[model samples]
Target: MPGKRPLNAAIIPSAKRERKAITLDIKLEVLRRFEVGEKLSQIAKALGLAVSTVATIRDNKEKIKASSQVTTPLRASRLTRHRSAVMENMERLLSVWLEDQSQRNVPMSVSAIQEKAKSLFDDLQRQQGESSQTEKFSASKGWFVRFKERHCLPHFKVNSTSPGSNADTYPDVLKSLIEEGEYTSRQVFNVDETGLYWKRMPEGMFISVEEKAEPGFKSSKDRLMLLLGGNAAGDFKLKPLLVYRSEDPEALKGYSKPNLPVIWRSNKKAWATRAIFHEWFTYFFCPAVEKYCAQNNLTNKALLILDSAPCHPVNLSDLSDNVRVEYLQDSTADSMQPMGQGVASIFKAHYLRRIFEHILEATDGEDKATIREFWRNYDIVDAVDNIAVAWEELKPATMNSVWKKIWPECVHFQSFSQTDNIAWLQRNIMALAKNVAFEEVVEADVGRLLQSHEEDLSNEELMQLERERAVGEGENEDAPPALRQLTTEALSVAFSHFEAGLQILTSNSPDEEWKFKVSRAINDAINCYRELYNEKKRRSKQLS
Candidate 1:
């Protein structure tokens, strides 16, 4: 052709290409332009990258942001090398080891790090039933250096005791801040995340004995990670973030993403991770904190407290000067976290209570004997809705009292305590459970429901959860599928709700305009349904 371009690396016109190392600023700017309605190809060309690179940025924005967290105010490169060793698995393993070592006051050397990495990899290979290599991966000095930098790991000499061991210093630090007037009660917030088996009963009471003996008795094992954020004063509460285990859970199949009731996210493992945490900080926590401060006429300064969980970002960058993060000492969160004090338990009680209330409502004023039949169909969607309800129902008074230990000055007098609320839940939940389950079972469940939640996720369990599994694929889900296929009786029940609303409009409205519109909508719907039904019947006869 017109002096064919020198075949430099032979542009083969194939899908395969080397991944580019894009700078964080470039990726972010591309997304900003996308939000402002610029074309991806245009943005890519301007940035001197392929259009597909721009598209990738748009597609996995959260992943990109997490990978790119800055170290020293530099726009760090976020691009990661494609490798057989899954970074997610590696991050979790290394983080757990680091935290454990930190708590033990043990400093890690480069060689030590390599040894651990090799051990972890070997163990994983054995678990996966892959033949072990004749020689283990070297995890060489260069690799260790890169790994340490990538994870922001420090290699200083051990001088002081572990964070877990030096419990006294943490309280001293917090108390000093209060005495110094560094932050007010309203400005102090404790944010902690915990796993919840949303559909789980206190026991396997939901499972039949036959089903339990048959195989997987995990019908109620649906889990979610709930991040609760609340101030010591309890005057303001940030909306809780719920992270479910699937990319697109069946419960959220038809919902509009932008109009969700909660700041929701998802991961394969329902457990929390740094990537998810970073996204939460950047998008949900920062904006909400700013809004809360602005509305309350409070100073913009806020102190957010977090525990040293493995998934928390090593350096949460770009937070404004007014916002500061304080990590709680290791092993002391149980004693120090405000959310742990009572807020989480209270919310869980209220969540269970909400579910019971739902069960009651579903009964339609029927005898309690029918509660069992009506309650069997509750799913993840019901649990999620109840989670929001439970979080909202926690009284400010109850939440404020939880901070009494550390922030006694901020603690205001309240008529009731968490104990009273727990008693109430136990009483009510026990009564409700008895109506549907065995009395002995109810007792066991009620005890469990009231107890503090446990963290029992093992490493292997987490690794198993991280493995990719296709969920609800290939099933033909109908577009515009009704919330549920309506029964004639159910339809009649629904009409009563509509009729009640229409009657209110008729009685309260100044004119017939509202009534006319509703009537027209119903007629149009009925006529369309009739036409569709007739066409379906005609097609069926022709096919026969």
Candidate 2:
């Protein structure tokens, strides 16, 4: 009976074939009437969609979920409190260690203390069960070690049981002597000798080159032994004192030069003569001070500050009542000597500068004779020349201005609130003045010598010129023979010799060191020039 009803022709025809699907936007007006807060089931039923699809969209909606492991405000505060407590405990432990060492004169080894503390702390932590699981009390161990080292070791001093001598009277004695006018201005002088050598290398320039294996490589054998004397006015009187020994005892017999002592032979094979010391004081130091005082109409009471050099001996009987010796404490020159702070540094700086500059300038001359003369004759004239040049460059206001700048820097005096030693004060002032003036003179002398030696171009310069000439001429098949020969001769003579000199200077053999190398290089250059001249003469004759 149901089959009797006929199906619609268009709808029934699609059953035999698949049809394309289309989507359409729906109006929510009908669906809005479903419920006040519509359940997904009710909304899906009204929309004619599956309950599963609506439930899927509802489940996917963003929702905030709190974690069970979150760090709350209370937890954070607890952590901070724990850290502070641990740090405080560590500091307390360190303080105990320091106080124990200070109170007890016993010294405890750091490693022993660290191990003991670490074991005790670790055990305490283990019993608590709330111990740091990562590592048990690392901060405590570190603090224990550092506390013992920095605070404890330096405070320990050896106690002396023996009765000490009353050595404090020396200062009082010295003060009395100074107040009594024992040291007159001119007679009170400082005498000292400084050893200078060519081995004095410039700071930052004394490089240890690996390829050059020589030990004690010096630039030259040239050296000077100068004895410098100065009174309270800072006037420098220098003498070249030579120290040598003669096998014959008769050779050491009484003889004296203007500023030098006669050769003194020794009875002891291992030591220099006692007479050398006697000679230094009797002939050089005492006479200089006495003469200076006599010339200036000053008293002969002089105070001398000297080191315990074997060459400088003290005899209370021989010394005049006015003359006194102030023996400085060993290794305390840095704090005690006025020269150590001021004059020495300035003198060395100027001295080295002049010496090096003189060496460089002298090397520029073509003739060996000229170079030799310049090197040997570096005395008063050299000093004057160098000083003039240095002064010119410095632009110092005047001699008085120079003195004013140098005096305060060189002299050290106690304040009026404290008693000052008059003898030391006078001596330092004079020493400062003399050193500054002497340095100036040396600088002036070097400058004048350098000025005189200045020429158009040296042999090395001429070689460079020739090289430039060849380069500028370009690639010419038939360049002038004379021009080519001149250039070749110049280069061949200068370069080969200079190369040899450089090699010798940088050699490893101790005997063939820099000094010897420089000498050889100079000789080679001279020889090369001679050969070039001879070859030129031969060519000239052949051409004729």
Q: Pick the candidate with the highest TM-score.
A: 1
Error in Å for residue 535 of model 1: 56
State the local distance difference test value for candidate 1. Answer: 0.64
Kindly give the stretch of ten consecutive residues in candidate 2 with the minimal lDDT sum. Answer: 394-403
Q: Put down candidate 1 lDDT per residue, 1-544, tens digits, no spaces.
A: 5787665435444478754556666677676666644567768877789887788889998876676664344435333323343333555576556644542234456676677777667666666464434434567888777777656775533434445555545667787876565788888888877667675556545443433454433444455778887888888888877777664767678887546656677655555567777777765677677667877888777787887666677676354456677777654565767787878787887887777677666765545435556445666677777888888888889879887766667888555578888888778877775664435456556567545244344344444443333232233211211222334455556667767876787788776887788867765545433443555567768999
Superposition-based RMSD of candidate 2 using all C-alpha atoms, in angstroms: 35.3
lDDT of 2 at 298: 72
- Candidate lDDT (C-alpha), each: 0.64, 0.40
What would the TM-scores of all predictions be? 0.55, 0.32
lDDT of 2: 0.40
Off by more than 4 A, model 2: 1-173, 203-227, 236-274, 316-322, 331-334, 364-544
Off by over 4 Å in 1: 1-165, 178-182, 204-217, 365-376, 414-416, 435-440, 449-453, 458-544
Residue 422's lDDT in candidate 2: 24
Error of 2 at 505 (Å): 53
lDDT of 2 by residue, 292-387 (tens): 666677775577765444445557326445467665433332233333333322343354455555655565556634433544445433443443
